[model samples]
Target: MNGEGKVVCVTGGSGYIASWIVKLLLLRGYAVKATVRDPNDQKKTDHLLALDGAKERLQLFKANLLEEGSFEHAIDGCEAVFHTASPVKPFAADPQAELIELAVKGTMNVLETCTKVPSVKRVILTSSIATVFCPKPPLGPNDLIDETVFSDPSVCEENKQWYLLSKTLAEDAARQFAKANKIDLVVINPGFVVGPILQPALNFSVDVIVDFINGKNTFNQRNHRFVDVRDVALAHVKTLETPSASGRYIIVGPATVTTNEIEKVLREFYPDLRIADESEEGTSPLNYKASVAEKVKSLGIELTPAETSLRDTVLSLKEKCLL
Candidate 1:
């Protein structure tokens, strides 16, 4: 359906990617019902309200991913819903249970609410490339994963990899439910999102970038599938409007790069920054170890170069005093 004049509910609207989605929706003349965990948090909603067209088109609602029917009020009268809320943590004590429950249950809850709302036609879910690519080597010299590849939850479960398992199951459940209920669902699976962070609140994912710029030794590995935040957000809006778009769309930048490459660019761009050494032993910042060219090409999206993406991210962080 055309987004103009139709209300769209964006879950986790205060988040990094969701915030951009809200901004674009408002800019495109769509009424937005943004759902956040705490509606009273003026710091979060204030910036959105201050954006152009937000005053007349934006509405904030308090909702929780774990709560049943919490999204019903926000989704009412909306033609589409962007389910971008998911528990994203570096480590979790009960990763499997918490991530799985939140991902699967939260998706079910949102879709359940959509069923009740007659106006709802589409649900754009914010999935990740983690659901498609496994975090291991030997993906072959030229192996690039796409929407057709689904992460083997069994492998993830054996390794106690809760995050991957959670995403896999969540997207799977979303697809199954959408088919049964006849709801049009479009899923965008993005790689390590790198772009200008709009909010001052740093997410867990951004911490890695911060560490890289600070010259932390723990992240010198050369493995990751990076994507620009703007591209991911733009893909979300495009998928929502594109009639031919269906199923999963893997949104990633041109190609993968190592942490060493990332650090070199940062050091070159900002010479004064505390750059990390390659000798330092630490976890790799690169999340998805696969290619996303096919999925992006299918959507006719041209990914931003890794150099440009990293440069923009560092510049943005410097401007915000995050560096």
Candidate 2:
């Protein structure tokens, strides 16, 4: 086992993508120290403790992302850290305090703790595609946005897109901190993640599907890049395992999909359900394509087809009686 004697810490242990990462890490034979808000909460910890290798290899630690030194106890002896916890709420009464500050401060606290821990090696930050090419830039018809391109923070703030702003600032803060402290940092920027839900409740991304099916969505009608939650998890592990992987990597499905396209697919899978056909006037349609370059492809990831991902997501929702 590649992870036979290795130890890793995963923040946000019970989250949709984080849970899958923990599962894969445990399967690889790594002793996992997973951090959550409440370790005693059965609803959150049970699913994690029930994973195949979890009984012996998994440990749940209580930590708050915003509190300094909260992560040290869990990260103390770990060789690798996967920081996946971030505020998913797009709108809040105080977006600056609740979203941006929390994300950046929490990320700094985790990195600060990592610096204190001698055993820590690499830190994998779960960033979103929103950080890249968001608030859509003016582009030529043939343009393709990649890692080098970043979302304009000023533009995001002007538009009140606080979630995107938070991710952008947080990732920037992480990069600067990692460089100054000399910590090996690898970032995984995944697009709209969809697939099975390991956690008992639905996450923001999966809820997008639910909202669509229930005709309750107010999300903008625009093209979006989609990726399976499992693929996102695998990318995190692969980035950690592959020593050569450094800097930022975009993780997304092969093609971009629109709201109508997604609804079309869902209608096929769940013909009985009344899915929404309309969307509020939102961001304009993308003029340029957004995709992953060869750098991520070099990791040898065979992406799951978008249809398969959508079908599997709904099936999982049904299994959980969420649909």
Candidate 3:
């Protein structure tokens, strides 16, 4: 096993992506100290506790992102820290305070705790593609975005794109803190992550697929960049295990997809479901833009196929009675 009985801590362990990370960590022979908002809440932590090696290796800790020193105990004596806890609330009355400030403060708190914990060797911060490209540049049809491109805070703030603003600022804060403190930090920036979710609740990304299946008219964007949740989780683990892995890696499918592509696959597999038609809204022609960076290729992470990801997502939703 690659983990070799090492100890690591994962913040926001119950989240859709974090839970899968915990599962993979355990399977690879690592003892995991996972943090949740409330340890006593079985609803949130139960899935984590039921992993293959949970009884022997997994420990749940209560921690908060905004509260300073909250992650100290959870991060103490750990080999690495996977700081995946970030606020996903998109519709908040105070975007600055609720989303932006909270995301930045939470990241700082985790990094501060890592500095206090001497055993912490590397920090794998989960970032998003929102930080890679800005809405202002208005991606040209021929443009290919990579890790070098950064989201402009001014652009995000001016447009009231609070979610992107939060991710952008939070990632910047993590990089600055890690550099000043001499911590080995590697960031995984994933795109439109959608796969069989390990967590019980429906995440915003998965909900996008759910809404489409239920015939709800959502999603302003025409092209949806999809990546498997498992692939994203594997990228995090691989980045930590591979000593040479550094900097940001964009984890997404090789090609971008649209709702029509997704709908076609869904309808082919599931004829009974009521899938939304893109023609209903008179969507533009299929513009499969949004390419990923070459950094992910260096990690040796083969992304899952879009059709396989979509099928597994719906199947998992059905199993959980959430579809």
Give the residue spans of candidate 3 off by over 4 A. Answer: 135-138, 272-290
Give all candidate RMSDs, comma-separated: 2.9, 2.0, 2.5
- Which tens-of-lDDT digit does each residue in 26-109 have in candidate 3? 999999999999999988988999999999999999998889999988898899999999988556899988888889999999
Separate clash counts for every candidate? 4, 0, 0
Clashing pairs in 2: none
Candidate 1 segments exceeding 4 Å error: 96-98, 135-142, 217-220, 272-291
Q: Would you give me the overall lDDT of model 3?
A: 0.85
Error of 3 at 203 (Å): 1.2
Worst 10 residues of 2 by lDDT: 278-287
Which residue pairs collide, candidate 1?
A: 215-275, 215-276, 218-282, 222-258
- The C-alpha local distance difference test score for the whole of candidate 1 amounts to 0.80
Candidate 2 lDDT, 175-239, residue by residue in tens: 99999999999999887788889888888889988877775544656565679999889889999
Local distance difference test scores for all models: 0.80, 0.86, 0.85
Worst 10 residues of 3 by lDDT: 279-288
